[model samples]
Target chain A: MKIELDNLTVSYQRHPAVHHVSGRFMAGEATAIFGPNGAGKSTLLKTIMGLCAPDSGRVRLEGVERQAIAYLPQQSEIDRSLPVAVLDLVSTGCWQRSSWFRRVDRAGMDAAWQALETVGLADFAHRPVSALSVGQFQRVLFARILTQNAQLILLDEPFNAVDARTTEDLLELVPRWRSEGRTVIAVLHNEEHVKQYFPQTLLLAREVIAWGNSAEVLTDDNLHRAVDTAAHWLERAPVCHVDGSAA
Target chain B: MTLALYDLVVSPFVEFGFMRRALIACLALALSSGPIGLFLVMRRMSLMGDAMSHAVLPGAAAGFMVAGLSLPAMSLGGFVAGVTVAVLAGLATRFTSLKEDASFAAFYLLSLSMGVLMVSRSGNNVDLMHLLFGSVLAVDDAALMLVAGVCSVTLVTLALIYRPLLLESLDPVFLRSVGSRGGLWHTVFLLLVVLNLVAGFQALGTLMAVGLMMLPAITARLWAANVGAMLAVACGVAFASGAGGLLLSYHLELPSGPSIILLAGLVYLVSLVVAPVGGALPRYIRARHRQL
Candidate 1:
């Protein structure tokens, strides 16, 4: 599906976190949003996903036959200490797809199992996520995404800090998603990965500083500017921190 | 009616009319409090319930001043006042950039002092005492109906939004993705809490209403895993505590509300050390055992 975020501006308490940003992410494209520490990449994604409202922008998902969207929030969004089992964690993804008030059905459980299998978490399906390694948790999150069967996927910093193996596993999954006609958007600090994997990029530092092919947006000059000027101090909106572990 | 054959268990529900009334009130409090309390603990709004319950005292006194011992009229005034405090507290949290508990504390203390002043100025000792300790035996049919109606609305609303609410409580940002309005749900959940606390205030007294809501739910959390099981266990314990306390109070002829609250508190105290999972001592023991 093609999604458009036109003139999107997200502000908090009169301070503009995301100032007048516009962009379009087409279907079957793996889009990467990158900036330094504080650039409003996460804020922009939040606005687009309808988590936070943009002061003046419209976000629409079009050109997709499927009506479903799967959202995989950053790892920081979940409490690591929570004793929830992996299967139950994935089952929550069905919250959006299933009807309200009704309990998760057999099909939902089946989907969760399938997603866990896809994420190589078939064995950890019954284990508590707290027991899993960091990479395991990320895969668990991916399993949640798989459960939704969403044509459009928005992931916030999927590869924030991980060993090479986990990164490679996730990097390999992106093209597979694109091959399957699924759209993926990930916010990241890693710039080289953009050229290596994703085809499109929306580089931001409080605004869309550059947008186009990965090679063009990941230019060293644009990269430094995005990090030093806009991103150096903006990502921690305080409102977005679930448990004060924003760093 | 042969009173002797039923005398052992019948007195609580049948022998003395006042006892029957207290027992029934306890039943309502128990059921209403279970699901309500579970969410409160899960959402970290236990203290908010306390703040709101205390905030209504001044309003309760105001109601008494206006209506002169009229139950419905006073309850309406109290309910309005409680809802106002909850909303204002929410606004203070959202607008002033103050933390939620801090704002709740400020509002509660202010309301508490004001309530005490109003009671002293406008109400006599007996009215203030009744409002504080509550006399559930004196609860009329109208009050019973009101509690029942509020319970039905709350239960139905809770049922309708259970999954989204659970999802948000567990991981709100995740809920927000794929089109969940976590903020909106937060407001709605808080609203439900206010309504339930206010409804139970008549039987529980403004002072003890929060205690009644929190203790059983907290205790239940110690006993089980999963939202559904926690809710059921909480309700069971809440009803038992309320009913047992009611029967005890009636047999002994004391204030029913305080009795029920004390009973709920008693359950909490037991759960605090011995509950299956989260209880402090039991958890420590389990950890030590695992180490061994």
Candidate 2:
């Protein structure tokens, strides 16, 4: 599905979190929404998912039901005390297809199992998700997304707190999804990580700084500006995002 | 000693019609709230339940004013108020990205204050306490009927939407992808909560109502290993609190509703301290065992 944000604007009361930004996310591609801490990256994706409606503009999700969008929020948003097993979590994907109180049918169960397998957690189906490592939990969430079989995937900081090996494991799912002609958009904090994985990127500092291929938009000017030691409000001198160590 | 505990328990059921009705309705409310409470706690929306409970005050007061303290009128009024707050709160939070808790806190406090102000103006000061604390002993046939009706409807609604509610609570993003609108599910669950409190407040009272809703479920979390078991334990504990509180209050000539709520709180405290694995006592035991 093609998503075009025609001068999208969303705000918290009067303060605009996402300004009049326009962009296009083509189908069958990976797009990274990258930015500094308060750059409205997540806000843009949230507006796209209809979680937050635009204040002054429109988000045209050209070819899907408003609810057909799949999103994986930051892992921190999940409740740690939840008692659901990995299998049970995956079964939530079949919810729209089933009646409210009905039991998971054979097909639904199969779908849950299939999702778990894709996330490589089929063997741990019965394990409580609360028992998972950070990476494992993220995958379990991805399993939820996969089971949704959504046309567009909106991921907000999926790689946060995940180790390198797990990051690779998760990133590998993108290409496979791309092969199936699905759209994947991720919010990345690490600039180098975005260059390493995503083919297309949108850079933001509460506005669209640059948008294009990672190598092209990730020039030293943009990189330096991202780290510009101007009279600023955040952590001291944003680190050189050229390498993982400084990033 | 001559009479078994079973016979003793049956004495109330056989002796008093009102007690039997209260017991039955209490049990039903307990069952209805267990699963919903679990999800609320998981979503960190327990306070939302509390807010919804308190939000019913104005509607209840209006109903009682019109119908002379009757069941249907009060519940209908409270249901309207409750659903309104739920819907309004949902809209306020999502539209503004103001934290859900912040919105809930705002609505509940405002409604609570509004309720109190109105009650004061109407010269119903003494009766207002009962609104806050409840009068379980006063739950007669009519109130019991209301409770039963509410329980059936709320439980059925909850069971039907169980999958989406649980999914959203645990993983809202995933629910959205599977054709679930976050606002829609939120509004539905909030409505169920409104109905539960409306039906239950006559017996449990608003203050005690949300407390009872949260206490048993939270206690159960410290005992049960999974969602199914948590619900089972929550209902069991709620029933135990009702039965024990009733027996103790009858023996002591105290208020049944407050006694039951206090007992629920006691159960929560005990579970917090003593569940075998998940509670503080269990952790202490393991530490002691290691030291020994």
Candidate 3:
């Protein structure tokens, strides 16, 4: 399903993290949200996921319910030290199928197992999540997303702190998801991975610096502008009152 | 020797009706509070549980002032007060700049002082002691029934909300993304905490009520590797501590509330040293083996 952002602005305490920017993510398009640190990439994703309310404007999901979207949040958000088994954690993705009180049926369990197998963590299913390394844990999270089997998938810095081998292994799943006609939006820092995998890119530095074709968005001039805009940001800048002027 | 062992343990529960009632009440508290406390410890809200126990005081005191030592009045009051404090803290955390722990601490301290003052103004020192420390041996049929009812409701509710509750604790953002309101589960959990604290205050008093909840949960963390195992271990510890504490109080003529809590505390300390999971002795042994 396509997601349309209509002049969205998300601010924390009056300082806008995501300025008024409008865009649409087409259905089945694998897009990389490429930006420097603090460029509102995560905030944009969160707003789209309806976790953060926009200060102005709105997010419109076309032909899909919010529940049909799968989100893989940053690792820091999860309590890895919790005494949860890998299988149990992965099975949580079947929550939509078996909401609240009902037990997950045989099919759901098999899906979870299949997900674990896909992530190469099948043996670690019964082990406590705390016992897994960070890379392994990320895989387990991916496994959970696989169980979710959502039409729209949002990944917020999914490859951070993961080993190169694990990163490559997980990165392969993006194209596979895209091929399956799932819309994949990912916040990523690695330019090579972006250029290699993603056909479309949104270069953001609080506002859209560039959008569309990855090669066009990742041009030297655009990349320099993104970094320069981010570096020269004023912390106490006045609120944007002029409509479309700031954009 | 066998007869002596029986006298030390089983006879107190078999012979005296009060002791029997006290044991049953404590078991009920243990049964419910163990799982609730496990979640508290899991969420790193063990101190929140303590704060909630103290927050129950002013309401129980208000009830006592109005209706004497009536079970229904005091429990209702305690439940109301505890829930009010919890909700206020939750709201403050949501709207204001104050963090959750700070808000809870502020509210509970205020509640504690107010409760102490109210109790002292209306009743004598002995009555105040009974309110603060509880009288497990003096538990009547109504009080026993309330505790049992709270326990049953708590278990059923926990079972109903178990998956969402776990998701809320472990990954709140993910829960929200998947269309579950984590705050709803959190509020429900807080309600359960208040309900348990109200029931516990009847038997263990406001001061020691959280002891049976927290101590067993913490002790279980030292021994168990997963949530289900942790829950089982916590309930087991709570049961053992409750029965042992009752026996200790009976044989030694100690106050029942402190006796129960102290016994739980003792178990916690012993578990800290010797539990197989993360306990000191096991870690030390593992370290030694690595070196060897």
Candidate 4:
């Protein structure tokens, strides 16, 4: 499915976290959103997932239902203290099909186990989520998202705090998903990482600096401009425009 | 000793109908409160239970003043009051700069004072005492019926929402992403809490009602690692304390409500020292083994 953001703006506590921006994510491609800290990379991704409302404009997903889009928030957002087992947590990915009224049957359980096997976490299936290492927990999250069988995946900093081996293991899944004709959009920090894996990049600093081919958009000048724009965003007054587009 | 045992433990319940009624009422509370309290503990809202208990007082007082110790009246009033405080505090945290804990504390304090004043103005010391520390042994048929009905509804509602509630409590963001309404589940869970509290206050009183809810969960945490195991252990502990407290009240001429809570407290204290998983002794032994 293709996603188009048309002049999207999201504000938190009356200050625009994601300013008026326009971009497009092509179908069946892996795209990375890279920016400096507080550049609203995650906010834009959230807006696409409909987790956050836009103060203006809208996100348009074509050729797919909203339910076909899956989201994987940062690992820190999970409450690990819950007594849920890894297997149970993963099985919840089938929630859209079974819903709360129907119990997860043998087939669903088998799929959950399969997802765990794919993530190399089959042995940890029955273990409490709290007992897993940070990397292992992230893998469990990936396993859950895999079971979602979604056409589009939105991830927020999936590699943060993850070890190199684990990161490599998880990175392999992105291409495998793209090969299967699924779109993956992720909020990533490492410029080198983005340059290596993602063909498309959206460079943002509370607004779009550049959006297109990774190599062209990730130039040093664009990165420097992104950082400068993000740093002084609060001091700049709103550029009021009758056309509903920021100058 | 056998005769003494019969006199101490068996005779009170076997011979007296009110004692049996009290035991039955407690058993119902235990069955429902154990699971409810487990969720509260897991959510780290232990103190919220305490605040909700205190907030129910003025409502119960108002009910008594208007209807004169009627079960339905007091329970309805208490449910409304508890839910109002919870909603108001929740709104305060969401809309204002105040934190949830601070808002709950502020609302409950105000509720406590209002309850005391309202009760003092309209009712006698006996009535106030009954609201503070319940008359479990004097549980009438109407009160018994109310408790049973609430327990049934609580158990059924909890079972129906168990999956969404678990997902919401553990991974709310994930729950939302999956198209589940976390807000609806949250409201349903809070309503369950209010229901259980309204039922419990009729028997355990406002001050000690949360004791039945919290003590069993605390004791269970020491011994049980999984959620299923924790709920089972908590229910077992709750029933044992209820039965033992009633027997003690019958033999030693003690207050039934205090007796039950104290027994539950004792079970919690003992579990802290001797429980198999997280107990002090087991932890000490594990540390020693690691050193070796």
- Number of the top DockQ candidate: 3
Which 10 successive residues of model 3 chain A have the least lDDT summed? A238-247
Q: Which predicted model would earn the best lDDT?
A: 3
List model 3 lDDT by residue over B1-292, tens digit each: 9999988888988899999999899889989999999999999998898899899999999999999998899999999999989988899999999899999999999888999999989999988888889988989999999999999999999999998998889988888888988999999999999999999988989878899999999999999998899999889888888888888888888888888888889989998899999799988875534542
Per-residue CA lDDT of model 1 for A1-247, tens digit only, reads: 5688777667776567776677788678899988776677788777666768776656776764322666666655676544467899899878755755777888999999988887788988777676898888888888888888778888888876677888887788889899998899888767678878899998888777888899878888887777676734544545432221121
Model 3 lDDT on a 0 to 1 scale: 0.90
Error of 1 at B260 (Å): 2.4
> What TM-score quantifies how close candidate 1 is to the native fold?
0.85
Provide the lowest-lDDT 10-residue window in model 2 chain B: B283-292
- In the range A1-247, model 4's lDDT, one tens digit per residue, is 5699888889887678887887789789999999989999888878887888998889988887776677987655677877789999999988887798789878788889999999999988889998999999999989988988999998899999999999989999988998999998999988878888889999989888999899999998999999998998545666545344544
Residue B199 Cα positional deviation in candidate 1, in Å, after optimal superposition: 3.3
TM-score of each: 0.85, 0.82, 0.97, 0.96
Task: Give fnat (model 1).
Answer: 0.46
- The best candidate in terms of TM-score: 3
Q: Which tens-of-lDDT digit does each residue in B15-101 have in candidate 1?
A: 567666666766777777778888878777777778878877777778888888777776777777777777787789888879989
lDDT of 2 at A102: 72
Q: What is the DockQ of candidate 4?
A: 0.67
lDDT tens readout by residue for model 2, B37-111: 777787787777788888999888877777767778888888888777776777898679698888878887887
lDDT of 2 at B235: 85
Give the higher-DockQ candidate: 2 or 3: 3
Worst 10 residues of 4 chain B by lDDT: B283-292
